[model samples]
Target chain A: MSVSELSLDRDPSSRFVPWIVAALSLMCAIALGTAFALASMTADWGRAASDQVTLRVATGDTDIPALVDQVARLEAVSRIEHLPREQVARMLQPWLGDVAQVDTALLPLPALIDVRLKPGADTSELRALIADRSEITLDSADAWLAPLQDLAGLARLVAWVLAAVAVGAIMLVTVFATRSALVNQRQTVDLLRLIGAADGYIAKRFQRHGLRLALFGGIAGTVPGLIVIFFATAAARLQGAALLNGLTPSLAGWLAIAALPLIVALVATFTARVTVLKLLRASW
Target chain B: MQQQGTDGTGEPLVAMRNVGLRYGTGPEVLRDLDLELAEGSFHFLTGRSGAGKSSLLSLLHLSRRPSRGLMRVFGHDMQDMPAREVPVLRRRIGVVFQDFRLLDHLSAQENVALPLKVANSMDSDRIDEIVQELIEWVGLSQQAQARPPTLSGGEKQRVAIARAVISSPRLLLADEPTGNVDQEMGERLMRLFVKLNSLGTTIVIATHDLSLPGRYGYPLLHLEDGRLSNESGGAA
Candidate 1:
């Protein structure tokens, strides 16, 4: 066949495959992006709360004056609130049952001072400072909370790994889908070759098809991803905790979600192009 | 044999000297074959089934390279030409396969318009006009809008033929083109080939039909077990 005649045999339906690939790729991007956003928010919350060390200080009547003097010498203390024995008892009344008269003889009721640490103070340095104030017993607020913060960090790391795995899976699926399309059109390719169609022409058709498929898949995938992210944020708020506080994606996040389709389309296009070229080189 | 017009140049349009073809170190399907097709000549190649007729046409169509010997097309040595330049040479040749090879998805008109579209030589309006004319000429006017699956065997053959000659190729190659058609249709199709040949196109048809060459009075090239013999009283 003449070059002019060979030019005419293109398939119109080839466009759809690339569009689908593009859509799928976009969805994968949104899934990955949302995961990162959530993880960052959780990390930030832990970091903010971990920066400060709060102490609860108690002193009996004999050491009251000395305890006050010792508390004044601690450099880590940012603000101290002094509470009398009656106030401490009143605060504990909700947890204590039927102890109004019985506890007066056995319980050693003492005055209390609540100490907040300065932002830059090291937890160990604050502990050492409190240890020097022997007349008052000081307990670090983070002694029990430290393990919880560590767990949150570990969870964030796992979320990141999960996101990476999802992206890899998306790529693998896209490659397989593109390969299927190429195989389906194998006869068309042979016909084109027989008619003297250039390799670039054949590759372009497949690339365009892949880009379209990725775009459609990506867009479709984003809707469910965003829904998942929304429910997650809502659940976190309902639980009286801020999961993605400072890292909450704004309008930009929504825009990125919208752009997922286009990004996937580009990836599909390039991937299909390379795959088709390789196949043609190997076969032709 | 009648002597036709001489170009004063002896070079044939297609010249293959001692050409041998094999698939991956296997025995050659065609071995040490010498052949030539002069400009504007009409020839019929006849052989039993599996006699390498298709293979030889494939080589002529530039789809495959000979494993040994020298081949040339349109005055360019096939061995010396770069791989990229093969397409340029193939553009001058048109082929009609035994199975019709029409794209199932396209309408008859679109299938016929394929060659012109690939070459990008004709505008859309011109392509449509030419395709319509060819469809009518092949007596497939009613089936022009029909897809290959919907068309009959004869209709598909017409579409394939229309596509092959749509660009007015310099050389036309047909492989059992009328194998599926009735006797009347086959004769009509042969008339079309003759008309195209008279208009200065070189035509080579490979067929199993024995009486076709006797009826048309064209030169016959017989092939049996990969060997070529000229039964007609002339140098081939």
Candidate 2:
């Protein structure tokens, strides 16, 4: 056996320490991965919403060109494209199936116009310009997607909270394991101390043990965690749902998840070192 | 037969002036221990079974801080020694407990090699050779791989002795150093201790068997009722 291992007697609880760290690492990886994904998705959605607006013009006796001309004059309105009636009809195909077979004259579809805006464009001026035109409704995509943005923000917060909780739990597990080892190897510790072993020297042995086990557990837990995330993202993609399009983790998110095991190992090692040092100092 | 002095050297290796120790609120286990073990001196601490020989040694070993009075080991005042400095102080003083206190999980050779490993003394390659030499000297070459549970009492004592002297500590405190060994083995261990002392290591052996010290003719520090009852004989 190595001299570090020889410093303390083997504790039965030591067998469970790595497994506990692994489980915690799994939780941490998933939580952090989710938070990172949500943050990335929200950022993209926010950018898109801020740069675009939509308008619905009524088809009943409304001067569409005059209304378009007025909106186009606004400083914020960079570009405006009036969506064709055929395209609008296609957009409603899922809700009103095969509207193409109906008479075009009988269809009461409103003219849809997509408006692109400059960055940081003021929307209140656009709202005031269309205030009197009841037939022309203005819709800022940012305002429309605000609730979803809030929900995503809340979810990101929850995931971050979960990751923090998992890290705290790993630290607590390390503390408990170190303490148990200390108790089990009390005689050996006494012998070492009596024979002039430095407290740091003794604590280092326990720290190295904890670090090795935590690293193993971290890898064990992280592999499965990443696998779960991978499969979940793939399944979402297979479903081809618009809502699930941005659920996959971003590059940074994947990196964070990949680093989870090492983080756990470091945290466990630090906690064990501090615990041993504190107890040893308290004893004297 | 009463005496109190160093070996005529400046700043003795270990010094205690009216030292006292107690557990919790109980009565003192050691009291009024005015003594010194100077450089390269060899001494025997003798007392009755409950006369605090082990307790006195514990003070020198830096295991317990004195409840009252001054105690110094390796020039650091025990009463004011910082917590961080205790281990550094202890590293210079080797101790052998009365109970052997060998880690059962470690092999005999590992137990014997503890001090060097603990002190991080010498290079790794030199460590193996030195440890092997010490183990063979203790006549445990065949039992080097054996764990403490498998070793006999005398064998464990030898391992403990080897561990105590591995680092060549400036001061060695042994409690019942030869309690479990035969006379022949005991004599052999004594010679090892004597050899260590001749190399400038101060030695203190606490034993109820007075004949060991009588034979060696080392200075004797006798204890009675938690006090140093007498000190006599030897060059010190």
Q: Is the docking of candidate 1 incorrect, acceptable, medium or high quality?
A: incorrect
Per residue, candidate 2 scores C-alpha lDDT tens digits across A1-284 of: 36553444357878888888889889988888788777776777877777788889877998777777888988998998888888988887888788778666677899988888888886787889888889888877666588998998899899999999999999999999899999888877887887778889889999888899899999999999999888877786679766567778988789889988889989989999999999999877
Model 2 CA deviation exceeding 4 Å by range: A5-9, A60-63, A66-79, A89-109, A118-135, B1-9, B136-151, B230-236
| iRMS per model in Å | 4.8, 2.1
Per-residue lDDT tens digits of candidate 2, residues B81-154? 88777877787887877788887777888777777777776676788899899888878999989999998878
Question: Estimated TM-score per prediction?
Answer: 0.72, 0.90
Kindly give the number of clashing pairs for every candidate. 41, 0
Looking at candidate 2 chain B, the ten consecutive residues that score lowest on lDDT are: B1-10
- lDDT for model 1: 0.70
Q: Tell me how far the alpha carbon of residue A120 in candidate 1 is from the true structure, in angstroms, after superposition.
A: 12
CA RMSD of each candidate after superposition: 6.4, 3.1
Find the candidate with the highest DockQ and give its number.
Answer: 2
Q: After superposition, how far is residue B9 of candidate 1 from its true place, in Å?
A: 7.8
Compared with the true structure, what per-residue lDDT tens digits does model 1 show for residues A97-169? 5456446445656567665566766556556655665554655535665675577556656655664555565
